[model samples]
Target: MMMNHCGLLTERKEAVPLKSIEVQLEVKDHVATVVSTLNYENKEDKPIEAVFVFPLPGDAAVCHFSAQIGQKHIVAEVKDKQQAKEEYDHALSSGQQAFLLEGSEEISDIFSLKVGSLPPGESASIGLEYVTELAVQADDGLRFCLPAVLNPRYQPQGSESPSVQVTSVPASLVPYSLSFSVQVSSPHAISKVESSCSLEPLQYLNTDQTQATVKLAAGHKFDRDIELLIYYKDAHQPTAVVEAGQASAKPGSLMGDPVVMVSLYPEFPQSVMSSHTSCGEFVFLIDRSGSMGCRMNQKRPQETRISSARDTLLLLLKSLPMGCYFNIYSFGSTFEHIFPKSMEYNEMTMEEALRKVEKMKDDLGGTDILQPLQHIYSQPCIPSHPRQLFVFTDGEVGNTKEVIDLVKKNSGSHRCFSFGIGEGASSALINGIAKEGGGHAQFITGTDRMQPKVMQSLKFALQPSVEDISVSWDLPKGVSATILSPPITTLFQGQRSLIYAQLTGKSSETTEGSVTVKFSFEGHPSKNQLHFSLKPAEDSGLTVHRLAARTVICSLELEWKPNGQQNEEIKKKVVELSVQSGVSSFFTAFIAINKDSPESVQGPLRCRIIPTPLYRAYIDSQVRQCSGKIYCPPSGPLIVL
Candidate 1:
């Protein structure tokens, strides 16, 4: 093995020769449309194939892809997954250049774009567009996260076949530069915009403060996920928007159907407001896998994943209510609990847990979170106290759908609050668990403060839940509505619920539409009603159709079952929807044009894997190479008192 100047054996290194990236986001109302353009140039004297693995929000609807090669611009079209892959392979085999972009079937949050056969010294510009709803943060602000971390995902042994394999490099070695800007528009006045990264001052384009623009400060590196928090003066107010269908498409289809987006943000009843005094059973599950041995932020090697998790866990331990029951479980390959059963949250128990947490390290084997989660769920629930399960992990699990299924199966026993420990945390795993378990998910990445987010989830877990949630729509005399989104299963205070509906038939010029969301809180039924004109909003584009298609596909795909017939049915629905909407899905992919031309210049090919943020284990191993002996740190046994 080769050793560096530090007298340490270096990890394997791959070359990713690339240039720059420009990202532009247009947020109208609460939906964000993102366009990212990558400029790839091969400095080598050979034709090269570059595979870039990137991150997108789990719920984003990717609608467009295009590439410009030597002044010739070509746009990609959606096709069946296997067919697209076949064509991409053929193009590459025929000594032609091709670009293939596709999302992971196992992990929706990760995407891979393969640009093959770039001639020497020539540059290819590839662009992609996606739309996603801005989730309301715990602090009452619209949150937009541009993922820059492509940390390696942990694939458990004996797991299902893998789909996409992610390769990562150190943050400093990620060879690409990123520049981003966002244009924000909403009916409500914009109050403020904030981010973890340094940002240029918000530029207001109108006197009423309804439109504004913001950009990342110059010199900011793409070391971590870019998060932007947008605050509106009246963030919780309900609003309705009706968008026109595509004029060139046939009527009655999703593309031709008039769609409406209803955002309902109802405040929880005063009786449900909770404080620390509220009693509950709190179970904390921490991941101590090898990956967790990595640093929480690449820029700061001292603040490791385990160390950060311990600090946050201690804060949570001290914040538990005096009379609540609590327990701690750490899992990697297997699992161990702090107590046989959840113990009372008294001074002695907390101190014991804190001490154990302090001594915790990434000594466990590969990450197998399912073993511990299944154990926790199988245990009987305590009487009178609601159970809230808190999971802290780096989101490296490969059995994501399986874990989420377990959460959903056992959801009746407890609510789950998930935390993604680092920038590369899988949004699919974290968000899916929370959604299935009827709770909330938070991400602690880069230099983000963890206290507020964890405390916020704690507050929500302690609060009373609303039941019997329902939505009712009233349309014009001839108009009928179909709900494109799945049924509402749970509701939390401060959480925003959005509904998308397609209107069929016709409405008179004076006709108005109304929607009412009803749920029972405390001991009575309450309703929130919004009335709006049926007239279509001008030139809203295909945002509504794409979003609606994404919603239905997501719903169908999630309806997995034990029966083979039912699974086949779901697969068919997903593909049908993806093809009809021209949007990417688990069963579909986007492939741009690539072919051999008479002017084609052929040469030897090179491969580059664009590195994402580096992992600490790889670094720590290098540190231990100081004298070819494994470094051991001294520590004391944990004591309750």
Candidate 2:
């Protein structure tokens, strides 16, 4: 038997062990801290081992994991991934209670948790906490998402699959319940908070409107991801936050030193913005995999992903400047191109492409984007015409790292604009390729109009590029700065650019510092500066420090080479940093063991897979329903965690 929910796959037909979940979210300005408590009970007659796989934001830093049974509580410790696995296995084999949580090696957003040796009739409460920076949307609203829908990733031939087999069932059949609430505070007055899921009225906690609280409306089925768009009074204003270091950590370390996070929204001159460039090459890549035939959302069952992509392509084709060059490519197991080379944009070529795009269907077998990308990069560039690549997909590819690395390798030749089509699209893949290629990434989900967002990116592509970007800091006499984030290579008008820096040495609380960002736009030089106080914010948690650490860790992970020596060194550094900062990484995991129980349980253990909810479209046609349960014949060997 096969069962699935939230990317979790189980091999047994027994009832799920998970019962309910409660979440608390606290937002301070642009960063958010989330804590989730999951309640589980083993009702079977024998001891069982339960495993669960789930999704999280790609950029989040998991800082805490703990478990409580009755009056006893156990806090997990971050350790090397291999070491943690060994310890967990030993505890399970010895009939002791243990818990382990680890991130996927291939995919950063997916994680697996194991509950070992849970005696029958026993109950446990698991706590998970993470911190992440919210992304700013085109309309200046900060976006916060709790990922609940994860579709199965399509692994290409000759690629090794991750330990978990991700599958899905209809959302209506999910047995678990969820409750969520949020407390938001910012320096600027809260304009409003909106969500794709139903939300209660926003209540102001203070007269100034700087503090507010909100909750998710009742009867929210886990059919789609929970997305919250938060708007502040002054959304585009440049701001800086300084957070103090951890007292228990060693000085001069990432966690021990104060970190400053600066948010910049660059403004271009009106003269340059008024004129859109007419001489550039635009390339569009569309995903035509079998899954593209699925409905975009449960709300709109008639509009499939392929149909939406087709409509968006029409808008893009119609909006292009007449003097520019463009082409279209669609891929699945195989790839095809509309033109042998990029053709000049004109009436004849535009109409020809439109006719072919309208005939496009989801006939492709699987999502294999690397081949078309490689072929695109192999072509020669058109002189005097910069290249901008627009990618449209549902983002179910498995080899995310390889695809992102390929884009980065050829980043100098072109800019990439990526769009994720549906709820379960891979954020890591969509954001990584765009970030590495120095362009923008957008997600279209839940009643969103694809044309507006695609056209916004088209406008960005038409805008003149920003060049000669540099960041400089003016600090107190004794203090020096070590930049943690990669240098800023791409900047768009009115887009947010985040910089993280570690402040070393000492300075008086009364001192002040300033940062200036200088860049060239359309052959004209311009700069923006923001002055901030040296004193760290009172009651500010280690959110900034953790975020900075995650930024650094991501950069280091990208630097990994296939050769042994460099890869080993990079792994060592990541493990050390991950352990020191208490942040989960690809090289490390969180493990907890209950030592209070003096005696081993006298029984053999059975393994139970905890079911999770997913969108109905995620399942393949081979799935059959019988007696209100979903089942599928094994496609391949089930790789248990």
Expressed as tens digits, the lDDT of each residue in 1-641 for candidate 2 is: 12333324333445567778888999999999999888888888888887766777778899999999878899999999999999999998887899998988778877778888888888998899999989888777888888766656777776675424534445566556889999999999999999988999999999999999999999987766788999999888999999999999899998999999999999988877776466799999999888788777667778888888888888889999898999999998899999999999999999999999999998777788999999999999999889999999988877888889999999898899998877768888999999999999888874464656777788788876789999999998889889999989899888899999999999665479999999999898999999998889999888899999999999998888556568988999999999999999989999999988657866888776555544443334332210011111111011234
lDDT of 1: 0.75
Residue pairs with backbone atoms closer than 3 Å in model 2 (clashes): 5-612, 5-613, 6-612, 6-613
Q: Who wins the TM-score comparison?
A: 2
- Model 1, C-alpha of 503: deviation from truth (Å): 1.5
Instruction: State the weakest 10-residue window (summed lDDT) of model 2.
Output: 626-635
The CA lDDT at 456 in model 1 is 87
Show where candidate 1 strays beyond 4 Å: 1-17, 163-175, 271-277, 298-301, 446-448, 561-563, 600-605, 611-641
Per-residue lDDT of model 1, residues 411-528, tens digit only: 8878999988876677889898998898899887644657788788887887766778889988878898899988887777667888999988995655798999898876567878
Worst 10 residues of 1 by lDDT: 632-641
Give residue 343's lDDT in candidate 2 (0 to 100). Answer: 98
**Which lDDT values do the candidates have, in the order given?**
0.75, 0.82
